[model samples]
Target: MSQMTLEKRFGQSTVFVASTLMENGGVPESATPESLLKEAIHVISCGYEDKTDWGNEIGWIYGSVTEDILTGFKMHARGWRSIYCMPKRPAFKGSAPINLSDRLNQVLRWALGSVEILLSRHCPIWYGYSGRLKWLERFAYINTTIYPITAIPLLAYCTLPAVCLLTGKFIIPQISNIASIWFISLFLSIFATGILEMRWSGVGIDEWWRNEQFWVIGGVSAHLFAVFQGLLKVLAGIDTNFTVTSKASDEDGDFTELYMFKWTTLLIPPTTLLIINLVGVVAGISYAINSGYQSWGPLFGKLFFAFWVIIHLYPFLKGLMGRQNRTPTIVVVWAVLLASIFSLLWVRVDPFTTKVTGPDVTQCGINC
Candidate 1:
């Protein structure tokens, strides 16, 4: 169930009208639920009798998970300023999804909702009320709303390294090159900053690492699917139904009954990526050995990324193979399709021509 609380500061000004208000002639017979909601806010902001407080009139409406944030965005776009509060002592607490499938569905719903708002006329960037928003606020809203779109670029980044490894194609600069140093430095800087931010947010190192693991898992499974679903809804006029997260059960410890086959589709991308990376790692090691360890540095880089993918995907792999966790047949089909596409890319790139020429021994006689 959805819940909300009006802050003490806004309590007196905010009016909560009942059906009785209509009988008393306070609200019109023709007033709709939407109109009544608007009127309540208006009356509160405008005040009744001698009291008129126009500028400070702000309203908040809570909808289902799929609509709540959208409602907030629409309201903000109508020249209203709102702050999202996360009190030190939580004002409200709710159960979250305890399993992977339910968690993914929750994330997908959020991503789809944000995409819907971003595509709508109420989009903060181009909407009429956009001018009323501060520049910083506008940027922040835009960033938040367009989060789903990042999945596309993220997908490419995640897959491209594995693809390169499979095809014996190197995108990273040579170890001896200045660009390599810069690239390594930049990656470490971003990683370190992420750790610092996580620490600042009161997360421990283990928790932060676990969060990153889930970040990869959720990005591939939920985020990518949501982006595609959102685009299909917007472009093809397809309707995407929302799935409510499963509530925690106190009486029964087992919640597996709440799990559905629909979630099995999400396993495809991560599973396929894992398989490809595993194959790439094996092939990379073989090629490095065959080349008399001439390309150990580049092979090591490829294997490192492949290992990263494997680490994040270990749980998914286990689930796929587990008899108790038996995945849907459709997941197998999707995995095969993904593998075929990868194989085509590998063949097209022609891994045979990718011989690594060891560095000139004379360039560093003693060091060599």
Candidate 2:
């Protein structure tokens, strides 16, 4: 029954996209339930395998698994964040979702899983001071720290930049402000992804890890992997083939009409970002003498950029070279995609071409 609801939502999105394709030819955002789940999950999990504690939800896992089995914190922080980006917002929003519903459900679920950890058996830890006295406290502290990552400059990003430049303010140097925000966003996003991957992998990405005897049986991010696979199944059923997002595995630029530009850029390879990364290893040695500043940073930056660019490149090239075998590959696919994009293209299509959308294209615009 639960799965059916999920499927229905997924199907709803597919129908919406397919209808859009049939109607407008194809707008990029088909927002079916599967893709929504994947996006939400990815945004939440990313490189999740690298965090500690899993935050506060450990207690909710309750007596199901002893303390010895658990590592770090209890809550699946990334998973929690990922939940926010789901198809429909939760009924009561963040407060109710986390504090009440998630808490009760996860605790019961964990208990029901009947999984145990070696750590639970060895230590008086789960029942001791750390277990009862400070579960939420630990999570609160971690959550508080992450707040600065997003909270500090949000007002500035949304409004202050224009205001500051107009007022000629220099208190928080514009360059410093932008750099800080961008770096913080990138670093935190990556860290969040890594941590989510680790903590929720068992439940979200792959279920094999849940066997408790699997190679990664103690996997923290098992939740996300399992969930992601389920979402993938949802996506597969949705007929989102015309939707171009990112490459599944091998990193490369590809037709990324599906997702937003910011994410696609992250997938783009640094080498292609500029020749600097591609040739920097050798170039830095030579340039270091002339520039005085360490060429290493520039070189590294380029290489890093290339890595991102390469991932995006596959799709970009595939689409550009006309080599893309977007299955059901009759000319109809391209025609539909172009038409869909036109219906939805509010801005320039970029390096692809100037397939612009007009105010006239907006169906819901006030012009009506």
Candidate 3:
């Protein structure tokens, strides 16, 4: 292919270029323009035959969108190893997406890449079994790929409270004392894990909470979409375009990027989630009041779940609002439109209404 390309472009001159470079010792400083071009072509063609790996594996691997990770994993699978170095001062610095849209798109790209790997032949779950890759390292890679799948359960969990509020019923079965003890133990373990992570990593409490908040926001939005997008590519052979993340502009005023808004479909899920949870809280509380419930247990339980969803998506809500003191008029209108439509649907459906059965149909009025 390289020879064909060179012939097509340079035709008979390719021979002269190679001959010149041979005499020039392949050094650009000592070589003519034609010789320099030949030197580049030699490296591109792997003519020197570097003994590190095969020609294809000379640089980054290319199957997945995240070629860097794929390359590293392949190296490790082949018995190669890497070291960790943490300098007291920073070794390098990089820019980040300062705005919500860019950040979400960046996350979407990464999640999509992970999904690509998860569904591919090189998926760490079942791949590299015959290789030198250790079990723990393989497990870490598996975790990286499968993390996006968590969005499925997360979305269900987030929407559960809303569904329960709207339908006036809980789908979860009543648990016995043993189940309650198990639940308490699980909660305590999770709490202990978080505390240990904070202490060991030197991460502040607020930072840990922020990480949790962003995890939900991305899980429901970007990761959820990535799973579907990846399925489309893998199952249906439809391709997704890779988009480069936009970086913060130095020309902008301080933190201006944070207030900048760009429309993306990724925003819709989280926005809807925020609205639904808020509605659930309001409707559940209103129902509790109207029914004059002697026990506040169920109401509080539903409210806790609803509020949990809302709190997780609060950052997303703020991003939609942008720099305005109030939410933008467009967002307000959109929210109101959704609320109105859902309200009409709820009235029509009335899922929780009890059926009285009335009189027998055989002895009914003239209409029957």
Candidate closest to the true structure, highest lDDT: 3
lDDT (Cα, tens digit) per residue for candidate 2, span 1-368: 35344333323233333443353343345466776676556434534222322222322344323232233333332122112234455555322222211222243233212222212331223333433335564444334222222312332232222222122222243367779989899999986775686676434434432332221111212222223333343445421121221222334334233222221211112112222222323433455556666645544443343344333333333333343443233334443454334323422322223456655637767765
- Local error of candidate 1 at residue 9 (angstroms): 16
Q: Cα miss at 347, model 3 (Å)?
A: 7.0
TM-score of 2: 0.19
Rank candidates by TM-score, best first.
3, 1, 2
How do the predictions measure up, each by TM-score?
0.70, 0.19, 0.78
Instruction: Predict model 3's lDDT versus the native.
Output: 0.77
Clash count in backbone of candidate 3: 0
Cα deviation in Å at residue 7, candidate 2? 21
Q: Which one is best on TM-score?
A: 3
Q: Where does candidate 1 clash, by residue pair? A: none
* Ranking 2 against 3 by TM-score, winner: 3
Worst 10 residues of 3 by lDDT: 46-55
Residue runs of model 2 more than 4 Å from their true location after superposition = 1-182, 203-276, 291-368
Worst 10 residues of 2 by lDDT: 262-271
- Candidate 3: tens digits of C-alpha lDDT, residues 1-368: 46555443333344433543354323334457776577557656634434333334536688787777788888889776677767889889878998887898999988999999999999998888899999888988889889999999998898778877776776466899999999999999999999998998889999999999999999998999999999999999999997899887678666877776776777767776677778877777888888887636777877778888888888777667646654445656565576557655765777767767666767887766
Per-model lDDT: 0.68, 0.33, 0.77
